[model samples]
Target chain A: MQSSIKQWQDWIGGIAAQGKFVGTNRLGFEGKTLKPNQVISDGPYAEVKEMVGGYLLVKADGIDDAMKLAEACPILQIGGHVEVRNVIPMSR
Target chain B: MNEKTLIQQLFKSEYRKIVSVLCKLFGAHHIETAEDIANDTFLLASETWGVKGLPENPTAWLYTVAKNKTKDYFKRRHIFSGKIVSELKYSQLNSESFEMDLSEENSKDSQLKMIFVLCNPLNPTESQIALALRILCGFGIDEIAVAFLTNKETINKRLFRAKEKMRMANIEMELPNSSEIHSRLETVLSTLYLLFNEGYHSSSQHSPLRKELCLEAMRLNYFLIENEATNQPMVNALMALMCFHASRFEARINAFGQAILYDEQDRTLWDEELIAKGNYFLIESAKGNEISKYHIEASIAYWHCTATAHNGKWEHILQLYNQLLQIEYSPITALNRTYALSKVQGNERAIEEAMKLQLNENHFYHCLLGKLHSEQNPKKAMECYEKALILATSSSDKRTIQNHLKKLR
Candidate 1:
């Protein structure tokens, strides 16, 4: 598992060398789950399939192009998947 | 060259100019749009040039494509007649024909403005260097990371923070007034100097050295000399310094990417043409009364460019080092002075001076001590070399210290 993680890092590093990398973030396990009013808890709960590990931002042309990039990500090899989103830029 | 290689070269040389001009035409807020259009122009060139067998004037071809694409964008979005018309000159707007003038003078002005904008005081020192490398020099993040001896992450963060600040402040893409040029010019020159030094003494193991960065720095400095406001004695001094340093690039690195110390470098391999240019600039730098640290450093470099152990060379170098230390008392300069002193006075006196400097933690300090102690005190020299070897981070620097240790054995 450690070796595979190293491999994943190398793959991401390769993309970075090409100057296409934007950035990434690391998520905390104790993310707050908020509801209406004063209801807040540490229960986005690992039981659900909707938990996010993190996000990797990159420069790509379109949805299909970004999808292609995500396909090379190593998360899927460990039973994890990627979710790509388009960030709508706000007007200045 | 192959079509792809030619296109890539053009992209490196002309990309920044096009982006700068476009960013000026449009506002600073639309810099991303300008970058996108420029990238598209390059992409189109890459796609079509292979089939068309290359254009006679590739740079002109790129400008034409960018202008036409920009015109099309304005027509399609309907913002040109409303937004851009107000920002641009009324004569240009009313003609119904908008031209992106990319004449040499305009391109030079845009690049000069970019240098000032990148070196704005709002940005931190590191961010200013990173922005200049990216915006004016057309360097990729990877190249910049290698140049600075840091990772891509750090360079990325610096660039992002700088761009964000630029956006918030809405820094104009135009030259500063004459009153503000002196202080701003100092920052610009220092940034260029750092860029040149990175190329001259690069820590990257793969490429080891980057002559391209050095050349780019010199090329930009030449632009300052061309303009009246920026043509100061210090600018000429910096140019002379770069030329002198660049003249010996061919002899500085070996085939195995090992650094060859200055004394051991092949004098014949040094570029005579560049040395002559350095001499010219050094003389030109003597015009004004101002004697900057650059002038003193350039004088030292000029002595080195002679590449001969003439009668008074070491004495002259020591004098210049003394002057430089008086002006800017950096440990690095002091470390260098000990060597020149060793030549002028004696090894024992030089060693005494070296030991007085509180640079015990610096690898180069120990390395110099190791050299000083080699003949008289072999055991002390061995210990100094060992310390240097342990402290050195880069493989090349470690290898250099290791070589000294090997000689002692």
Candidate 2:
């Protein structure tokens, strides 16, 4: 049931070789949760029992292409999912 | 079992139950098929229970599924026709109805007999031990390998040969006839006794795989007690002895995984409940006039558990050991008796008896001699410790001897 680190590395290496690598960031647990009346709690998302394994960004042609790319990620093989979001550029 | 360990513990127990019953129904030659059905049942449980949680009566749920699977197996392949019992003749007779008996009573009967079936005397003792560990205890090949300190291929080969022997003998999973019952039961009990001893005094104490091996042996022995034909006096004595030994299991090992000698173990860690169980079974064992070596050994164990200063505990233990050696003479048992001899008759006489055995290659022999001389003769104790330190195999034992040497200095 354990997906090894080598598997993750190999999959990521394949994507990087294809020149579609964008960026990645691990979630910093040192954050706050702001409630309805601005009451904040100093912890990670308290409600999520399923752990979030941080995020990876990838360059793609379109949303469908990005979806296709996301579908090939190793996370999907191990019962994990990928959310394909558009990173709109801030043009000056 | 709680939700965390519910599946595992159920698998350990229910796997054997279902397999035993299936082995009886499907015949010993189809043992693999029986195992496959049990495995599939567990696989289904792991998937379903993970999603829906455990059923109210999980064992019943498993039994119901196993029954259905057996029914499906019968339907898929016509395993038994009316003419021949085991033909595997496929047919298109959908109208032919089948009934399976997966009742609790049948399951108990099946398992009680399965122990003897696995420990068939035709097979070598090693093969019997391997088969018993595999079928009865639900131990994996890898686990059995770890237990035996061997590789998987060797274990697999032994299992194959043992199964071949079973097939050759045309063995069926049932109790022996009244004429053969005594001898057959002796083989079964001896296998269980060796299994328990393997767990207690294994070469690799820290392996952790043997952590439950002793309990598994006791559990298998318990099935014999539950059955009428197999519930002889010797069975209760063995169970009593196991209970007595198990009661001190926790006290025998310290936080550092070092073995604590009987004298040094904290009395508070002794399990009162298990001692009570041992007492009950000892009483049960004494009902018959047949005094097995197990009975005498259990009496000695009882003395160890309930010893007071003025109670002549060592004397009674020494007497019991003498009785045990008379019933069954083994070098190891006689070696153990000398420890009691030292306690009862002082060091000099015990040392003489211990040396007569001439177990020069055995580290325990030298270790015992070292203990006997530690008070009166430091030079002799040092020499014995040196021999023990070199001859000892396990690190824990070496450490124990090292401690003795430290004191002797």
Docking class of 2: incorrect
Please report, in order, the local distance difference test score of every candidate based on alpha carbons.
Answer: 0.81, 0.79
What fraction of the true interface does each of the listed models get right, in terms of native contacts kept?
0.00, 0.00
Q: What TM-score fits each model? A: 0.76, 0.75
Q: Give the TM-score of candidate 2.
A: 0.75
Every model's DockQ: 0.01, 0.00
Flag regions of model 2 displaced more than 4 Å.
A1-92, B1-4, B48-57, B78-96, B206-208
**Most accurate candidate by TM-score:** 1
How do the residues B1-409 of candidate 1 rate in per-residue lDDT, one tens digit apiece? 9998887678778988998888777766566677778888989999898888899988889999999888877788898888777776444663257778788888887777777878888887778878877777777788888878899999988888888898899888777787988778888898888888778776766453388888888988998999887998999999999999999988988898788998889999999999999999999999989999899999999998875778789877876776565455576777787788788778897887676565878899999999999999989999999999889888888988988999999
Considering just chain B, what TM-score does every model have? 0.92, 0.91
Model 1 misplacement above 4 A: A1-92, B81-84, B89-95, B149-157
Over the stretch B1-409, how does candidate 2's per-residue lDDT look in tens digits?
5554887778777787888877776566667778888988888888898888889998889888887877676567664454224332233323145434577887888788788789888998989999999888888898899899889999999999888788788787778899999899889988998898888878765436666888988988888898888888999999999999999988888887778998899989999999999999999999889988788888988988984746878766666665565455566666777887778668997786676556789888898899899889999999999999999988888899999999878
List the pairs of residues colliding in candidate 2. none
- On a 0 to 100 scale, what is the lDDT of residue A86 in model 2? 87
